[model samples]
Target: TAGDTAGDTAGDTPEDTPEDSPVEDDISSNKKGRFHSLGVGELLVVKQKLIAYEEGEIAHIENVMKGEKRSRNHRTLHRTEEFTSFELEKEEETKRDLETTTRFELQKEIDSEVQESTKKEAGLTVTGKYGPTVEFTANAGIATEKSSSKSKNLSTSYSKEVVDRSVHRIQEKIKEKRTLLTIDEVEVINEHSFGNLESVAEHTNGIYRWVNKKYEAQLFDYGTREIFEVVIPEPAAFLRYLATNHPKEGTSIPKPQKPGYMRLYPILGTNEFEEVFIPLSPGLLTKETYLKWVEKYNIQDVLPPPSSFIVTSIAFAIDPVDTGVEDEGDGSLTPNWRTVNMKNTELVVPPGYVAKIGTLSLAIFPLHRFILRGLFGEIAIGTNKHAFHQGGGIGGSETFVLSNETGLVPVAFSLTTKQFFSGTLEVQCRRTEEHMEAWQISTFNAIMNRYEVLKEEYEESISGEELFGSVDIQGKNPLENKSIILNELKRQVITQMTRQTFDEFDAMREGVLPEGFPQQDVDEAWSEGQYVRFVEQAFEWENMQYLFYPYFWGKKKDWPVNSRLEDTDPLFKSFLQAGSCRINIPVRPGFEIPINIFLSTGEFPWDSGEGGIAVENEDGEEERDIFLSIAEELKAQQGAVYFKSDGTVFHANEDLESVLTGDLIEEVNDDGDVVLNDDGEPVLINGTNFLEDDINREINIGGKIYMIIAVNEEQQKITLDENISIQESVQYGIGAKAIGVPWVVTVPTSLVMLHDGNKLPEIPEAP
Candidate 1:
C-alpha cells in the first residue's frame, strides 16, 4: 500500500518535480526496475547526484523508504519464512548499495574542495597593511574562494609581523657580535663621561682646522656621508685624519720625509742622553712635532727623562760613639777582650739616587749593621799593627780593598742586603784579579789530591766499621755511634779543608810564601808540647779513652806526596822522592793537621793515653810507671813551641752526660696523665732506655727540669714529676753524667783572618 501511495505521489508531482532531480519521471515510473537495471557506473552517477541533494530531500527519501519497508513487512507477516528471508535480503542489499555510494560521493566532494583550496594557496600573493608583500605562484592551478579568504586573514598585519621578525633577527646578530663589559668597566662608564670636555673641544677644533687646510671636497658629499656611516655611524662625525687620498689630486697623502732618529734630553740637564728612533707615519703626530709640543707645554717638568749616575765607591764614616766604645774605655786602642759593636750605625743611600757601574744600574737600599756583620763578618775599617806586619794606621781612616776572590760584594748585596734591606743604600766595589801562577796551581793540586786520599781512607776504614772496639760512644749502638762519628768527621773535614784551601790560595795570590818553599821540617818539640797539653786534658777527664779514640789513631797507610811533601805529584819531574811522606794527623772530632810521617817512629803519631793501664813489672808487682816514663820522655824532647800559619789547635769540651736524650713520642697533657697511642698503649719515646737503672734520675724536658719517678722499660717511657707537661717530639735529656774527655780540634784561622783581625767575642764555656 505504501508503494502504491509513493507511485501515486510521484505521478501527481511528475510535472512539478525539478528537472535536475535524481528521482525524475523515468526513475519514478519503474523505481525498483530501473535501479536493478542500472550498471555500476550508472548507479554511481545517481549516488553522486543524490549526495549533492539537500538534507531535507534525503530525509524525505529515507522516510519514504521506511514506510515502504514497513508496508512490505506487514504484507509478508503471514507469508512463509523463506519468502520473508528473500525480501529482507533484497532490502538489505539495496540499503547497503545506497550507503556505499553516499560515502564515496561525499569523500569525492571533500577531496575536490581540498584540491581547489591547495590550488588557490599555490598561486597566492598577500600584501600586508604595512606595505610588506608576499607573493606565491602555483605550477598548474588558479586561486579559489579559500585563497581569497586566506589573503583577507593575513593582509591585516602581515607587514608588521615581517618587520618584527626582521628586527628580532637583527637583534640576535647584534647580541652575538657585541662585547659584554666587565663590572669595573660598566662602573667606570656610569661614574665618568667618555672624554674630557675641554680636551674633546680642543681636539675637535684642531681637527676642523686641519681638515680645512688639507681637503678640497665638500664635507657633506655622498662619499663623505658613506664614510661617516661606515666608520663613525652613530654621532654623524667625520674622521678626516683617517683619509688616505686627496680628492682633487687623486693621490695619497705624503708621509714625513724627516730623519727616522731622535734623541731624548734629560730634564735634569745631563750630557748623557739616550737616542731613540722615530716611527713616522702620514698622521699629524711625529716625534719632532711631539717633542716640540712637549717643549712648548713644559711637559718635561711633569714627565722627566730617566737619569742615572755612577757611584765609584761608597764608605761608611764610623763615629767614635758608634764604635761600641764607652767614655770610660780607651778610645785609641781597641780592648783585647771587648768586641766592637756597630748596632747604632745608620747606613742608607739617599732616595732617588741610582748607582750605575758601567752598564749595571742598581737601586741601593739601607742595610742593618747586624745583617752586614752576619754576611760579611766584622768588616774592619783599618789595618791592625799586631795582626799585619804593616805599620799601625788610622783605625777608621784606611779603606781596605776587598778582593773579588772574596765574593763579598756579590754575596752581601745579592743575598743578604737584598733580602733584609728595602730602602736605598750604598755598595762597596772590590778589586778583581786576572790570573794565577804555576806554583799555586801545583800546590793546590797537591793539597786536593791529599785531601781526597784522606777522605777515601776515612770512608774505607772508619765509616764502614762494624764495631768501635767495645767503647761506649754517646750511649748509642755501635752502628749509630759510627754514623754519628762519621757525620761529625765529615762536617769538620769539609769546614777545615775549605778554610785551609782558601787561605793557601790567598797567600799564593798575595805573594806570601812560607820560608822553606816546599820542603819543611817537622817541629818535634812543638809536637811534644801539643801532646803534653792533650795529656793534661786527658788526666782531668773521667773517660780519657774518649779523647784518645777520637783524636789519636795508629798510622794505617802512607800517602803519596811530592818532593816537598806538599803534593801527591813531584814538583819537578827530575826531583828525587822525599824521604818522608805526608800524613794527616788526627786532631779529634774529624779534624786533621798535615804533618810529615817522620813525626813519630811508633805506629801512631799521638799517644793513646792507655799506657796508664795496670801492667805487671818483672818483679810481679803492678806498676803505673809506664805512663810516667812516657811523660818524662816527652818532656825531655820538648823545645820552643811552634805554631802553623794555617792551623790552630784548640780544646773542645763537650758534655756527654745527656748523650742518651730522646724526643717525647706523644704529647703530655697538663693533667700529667700517661699519653696513649692509637692502639690504647702508653706512648713512649722510641730507642730510649728508662727502666730500673734510670729511675729517680732527673731529666730536662723543653728546658724544664723534672725527676723520673717511674720507668717502663718495655715501652721506653718515663713517668716524670706530675707538674710538668711536654709537647710531642720535645727533646728530653737525662741527668746521668758520663765520663767525657776533652778533644783537640785543629781549626784553620784563615776565615777569621779574612775579617781583618776583627775577632768575635769568645764563647763562654758550657757548664
Candidate 2:
C-alpha cells in the first residue's frame, strides 16, 4: 500500500495540481516552500513520495527547485526551508522509518521475480556476448527420488592420472628441444698456412670455454703472423655443457702432464746459481763409507747436479797466411792450452787418431779446483770441478771448464775460422776421455763442420767483387778481411750451438731419444732431482732466455738475430710475447658484428727491471712521471671493442676509455701496491708510449690478432680490415712499438656493442 501511494505521488504532475490551490500559490509567491505544520507521520509520507520518484522525474524536480521551466505554459518550482532542530530530528526519524519499510518491500519483490526466472531457466543454456554458452543441469528431482548410492572416486582418479601423464610428456618435449638447440662445440681452422702462404686451411685444434656469459678459446698460433677463421653456432643455454672450466689463479696444484708433452721448468735467477756444486753420486750417498768419505774429505757444500746446465766454449783457427807471416803471428798454429792440475786427474783418451785441416785436439777437463783440507788445515787433496752450472751462472763464475762426464750439461761450442778457403774443411772434435758419448762428439763435430761450410761461403761472398767494390773495406788487407769474416763466423757458430743445445735439451726432457741412451739417465736424474726447483726458477725468470729455457724455446723463432745489442735482451723490452690461441663464442643474433681487439705489449719504463728507467727520486719517494702515469692510465683503459670490416668505425661502451684526451686518476691494486715485475720494480701493463705508437699494428687479443689499419688517438678508436666478434672474459695482449720502445700489455675483454646510446641490439629467442 505504501509503494502504491508513493508511486501515485511520484506520478502526479504540475498539471494534476489544481491551479486554484492555495498552497501552490503561496510557494510561487515566496520562491521557496515550507511544509505546513503537519504531524511526523504526514512528513514521512511526503519523504517517501519524493524518494520514490524515477530518475527521469528527479531531473524535473531539480529543475523546478532551480526555478527553471520544463514546458512553455506550465511552470514547476520546488524549494526547502530550514526547520527547527527538534522538528528536523522528528522528521529525520520518520523519513528513516519510511525508507526502511520501502526497501524491505522492494527486496521481497526482487526475490520473488528472481525465483520465477530461475525456475524458467533450469536445465537450459544461457549465452553471453563474450563467452561460450554454459548449460546448468538441475538435480533437484533426482535427489528427491534417489534409489541407489555409488562412489565416483574411480572416474576422478582416472581423470587425474591422465592429466599427470599429459604434463610429463610436455616436460619431456621441452627438454628434448632444449638439448637439440644447444651449441656444444665449435671448430677453428687456420685460413692460411704460416710456412706455406699458398696452402690454406691448416687445422689446429684448440680448447674453448663459456665463462661469465661469454665464449673463450685458447689460441695455438701467436696470430702476430697468421690469419685464422672461427666458425660457431647460434648461442643457447645447452651450449654451456661443452664449456671447459676456467683455470683458477694462484693454484699450487700442478696439472697432470699429457703423454709425450715435454715438462717445463721455471727460469733460474742469479742467486740460485751463486754457489753451484755437483754431487759425485745420486740420491744423497746412502752408503756409510761414502758419507764418511765425504765428511773425511770435508766436503761442506756437496749437492746433486742442477736439473740442467749450459756449457759454452770458443774455438779459434787462424789461416796459414796470417800465422805463417814472420813477426805477424806465431809459427805454431796450435794455441797453448792449460789443463787443471789435480792429484787424481787421470785422462781417459778414446782410441781415435786422425788429423785434418782445421782439426784441433779438444781436451774436455774440469777447470775449477776444489781443495780437501786436512785436520792440520793443510790441503790434503784437490779435485777438479767443471764449469757446469745452472742457467743464470753462465759466464758469472771464474771457472771455464767442460767435463765430458757431465752429460746433462748442454755444450754450446763456437768455432771461428780465420782463413778464406774454397774447399770444405773437416773439423774433428775428439775428447781426451771416453766420458763423452758418440752422439755428443758427433753433435759437436757437425756444428764445427757447418761453421766451416758457412765460413767458406761467407768468405767467398765478400772476397770477390763485392768486397773490392765496397768503399768501407776496399783497401783492407787479406788478414783484416779474414779477421772480419772470422768475427762473423764466430757469431754464427755461437748461434748455431745455442740453438742445437736447446734442441738437444728439449729432446732429452721429452724422452724422445733412442732407448737405453745415457741421456735417459741424465734426464731421469734431472727430473727426479731438483726439477721442481728448476721449474720454479724458470717461471720466475720467464722473460729471460738465459734464465728460463722454456721461454727461450718458445721465443727462439722470434729472436732478433740481426737486432741491436740492446734489443736482444728481454730485460730491455720489459714485456713477454705469448703465443696466440683461438677463441669461439656463441653470440646472440643481430650482434654478430665482428670486433677486432688490439692490444699493446707496453709497460712503464720506470717499473722495468735491470736496464729500466729509474722510478724513485733523490728524496727516496716514488716520483710520478707524467709520461709513466699516462702509460699506466692507458693500460687500465685497454679493452675490447666492436669494429667494422673497413677498419675505420668501431663502437665501445662507456666502461672503456672511448676518448683519450682526458685526465686519468692513478689506479692502485687492492694491496695498495703498483704492478711490479718479477724483480719488484714498478711495471705498467701497457708501456709509456702505447697511445703514441698504437696505430697500424697487429695486436693479439683473445687468441686472435687484428691489425689496427687506422687509429684515432683523440677518440681512442681503432679500425681493422676484417670483422671479429667481441667475446667477454677473454685476454688481450697488445704489442705496440713506441718511439724506439716496444712493449706489451694484457687487456681483459669486457664490452658490448651498442646500436644507439645505451641501447643494445635485440637478442632473438633461442631456437
Best of the candidates, TM-score: 2
Which TM-score value belongs to model 1?
0.13
State in Å the error of residue 593, model 2. Answer: 48
Count clashes in each candidate, considering only residues at least 3 apart in sequence or on different chains: 7, 34
Tens-digit lDDT track for model 1 on 405-468?
2111211122222111111223343222211122223333333334334443443343224123
Model 2, 666-764: lDDT tens per residue?
A: 335899977666787666432112353555444555466655555656554555546555533233344432122223322222212212222222455
Q: Compute each candidate's TM-score over C-alphas.
A: 0.13, 0.15
